[model samples]
Target: MYGDWSDAPRSLATLGYEPPIPGLIGSSQAMMEVYNLTRRVAGSNASVLLLGETGVGKEMIASAVHRLSQRAAGPFVKVNCGALSESLLESELFGHMRGAFTGAVSNRTGRFEAAHGGSIFLDEINSTSLHLQVKLLRVLQEREFERVGDTQTIRVDTRVVAASNRDLMDEVEAERFREDLYWRLNVVPIRIPPLRERREDIPELVAHFLNVYSETNERHVVHIQREAMEALQDHDWPGNVRELQNYVERAVVLAESDELTVDLLPPEIRSGTKRPPLGMSAQAFDLDTLTQEVVQQGLNEADPDAEDLHSRVVNRVEKELIAQVMQACSGVQTKAATRLGINRNTLHKKLKEYDLDS
Candidate 1:
């Protein structure tokens, strides 16, 4: 059994790395509000629930909060609730004593216990089963728990921070999540805007990713072409920053020169003329030109890639874009077909055509 937790508050200044509190990458008011909320709630113990689409950087915000909090000196544990099964997740969070189950051979300290005097980040908390949620609720309420197959109670003083990419309210309404638990976890809700909603931030995020990856890859790519920037800012980034990061990394690796031109962008993005109608202006269209410009700008410091590798990369980009559009439409054959600008019957044939739907 663990001893009682000390309630003394620690000073944030003692922590070496101050919270790199996410700032407004854009001047947009929505992003500014998000930054302000993150800064304001950084020092609190209240459970924070980050709501956003995938790749919006909820985990980054969570880390910033932990770094700024009074418990900065202690462990910052993270668990992906959606990644584990119910039984495994229970043991992972609350732990199990030796011989607690068939696979349990020794005593274990779960995320909660490991996070004592610190913070535990529960990613995709909505994925937890009701039974597991009850246990979690108990821990949140009592700050105490017992290992599986052990009656001895263990007390912890871990601050909880949970995040989800799904619509939690919709989940609750569908009986897929516990309402009470949702309320408890939502003490300080932080909503991250999707990339499409904050398209203005594309330039800044692009610059940041470019600089980081270029140095890491020993490249000196310094500029972006105007048409390339336009393509980047115009496309609806359904995958958000993550997609952008992948593009930059790929660009750095395959860059023929020190510039990041649109040619480095995936085929779907480069083929701006083929982009599905997003209710945007057609005057901005010029996929190939944009690609050439951006690729030229970022290839200055990057190594040249062989023709075969470049061809393979183009194919990979095509595959990924197709997959993303299908997923965004939730595997709905017709909608996905429409999004991809193909006939429904052709999409049905393509499902088997690409061996994807199977």
Candidate 2:
């Protein structure tokens, strides 16, 4: 291991920086397409726009791009445009000179200058105000910025990678975002599909998260029960991979054995009934088979008689189906009900009866 250590200087170039590997683990066709695109775009200097829902790991793609670029030795700066107030966001992006504002006792370098010869990632770029959009457009067009209080223009060379969960085209139509800036940033667009659309990748994602959080938590959850894995794959993950990771970490901490079980899941997922994949045979229905099932056994001790049995069974089935639909729709009740072939009012009433609405 130390064979070449004594002969070479530890310069940035010699540090042997390999590109940061993405944590994504999936062989599904959808993910393979994204991986191919990522690899192809990594070598270029062009600005990239990553479009995806929250918790879909847009920043990871940005980092991969920076690491694979020729400017791998330079810094990678990330800014969350949605988290800061407008004034603070402006100051953060462009920096400020001494005595520029209340807390400006000294001059400071902005993210752009700090990331000189490297890349800057702007997350939630759609959340920025219109005024800030104009300033940002100027920076992208001129590659220069002035300090908050200084007239001197500072020129910096930095690659930009912007990400947003919202539809920029819709924003343009609504006049909430600048069309010119949208065109400028969307030079090369990459869309990340949501978890539901790529259900086949759920198993791989679940396994990867389990292994990752297990190591972090110092637990020995080496395997997941087949039933548990099936439940994970069938349930609609509204929060996508982030939610799955959280559940896995929770299971690791609460699990009594090395295997993950349905009991370890949150109530919604644990109680959810799995739906068959598309084109699968529809199971034969038997009233007697379902009649023996208990409805909220502990909570509702008043069992339904023959007269109310139909209503109860219909309600129970509807509740379970709606819960899964809501998960797939990311808790958007209107969308969920529509997908379930029911009105919002009917869905809301059932949600309350099932004690799931809250």
Candidate 3:
């Protein structure tokens, strides 16, 4: 799901100093490709659509493209489409004349006019209603729109950069989004991969955030222990880079020394544990035989000369089995009992008798 630097074009490594894309992290081949695509499409006037889950930094990439583009000198405006109601959103995008509605106290310029000769980033554009979508489609097609409660059409020149966490195509298929609007915004599609897909970049991102937070919070923290780093790398960051940035900031603020250690990490991270899939092992089919062999070894160590083989075997296997089930269930005794095909109280009694309660 991630591109290793090894997979990137070898020529890029040797290319004479071109300043790295500002504020956009791209150590992996996947991100480097995004950077390259951004540069390639920067000069064009075509609308761009950035697609990814939340916190994947679609806005940052959009900024990069604008910075490198001819519109670098123009203002960069942004609006969260999903954050406003349909009526308010229309006024926001297309402006409204005085007394356009109950709250329209004065004539207002829309985001389009504010972003003239610049760029307007419509984040979460997929959440717009069909009526709003029609208006957006008209703007994209004619580059002219009428202010609410005004018959005059105002012309504006601005590049549109729309982003969505949802797949616009899927939304269209479900009849929730307009296909024409989808095609209009998706003139140049860019998908930002989630953080978990780029684990190779975690160490660098951690270090970057560590320095940032340390300076901002006046912390002396300068290094992350290898164990702590391994835990960070192994985590599945559902919130992407934003989550990583926040976590590193939290650790830095909580740090008592110059280095981060596993002791300061969250329990899940420090444990680095997950449930093992059922019946998955090196020899899945031979589990019963292996279990018997391990039980026999434990029994011999407990009592080598015991004449009552059945009792000794039963006691040893039961204790070991209970302990293993408890561990695999993460100390949930009820689940352990279910896995063991026994009642919860029976498991509790066994735990007390064998002194494996912990």
Highest lDDT scorer:
3
lDDT of 1: 0.78
Best by TM-score: 3
Clash list (residue pairs), candidate 3: none
In Å, residue 157's CA in model 3 sits off its true spot by 0.4
lDDT per model, in order?
0.78, 0.78, 0.83
Worst 10 residues of 2 by lDDT: 277-286
Task: Give the poorly placed runs of model 1, Cα more than 4 Å off.
Answer: 1-27, 273-358
Pairs that clash in candidate 2:
none
| Cα lDDT tens digits for candidate 2, 217-308 | 88888889987887788786767777777898899899888999988998777767644432222323344544345344422644544467
Model 3, runs deviating above 4 Å: 1-19, 273-358
Model 2 TM-score relative to the real fold: 0.70
* Clashes within 3 Å, all models in order: 19, 0, 0
TM-scores, all candidates, are: 0.71, 0.70, 0.72
Q: Is 1 or 3 the stronger prediction by TM-score? A: 3
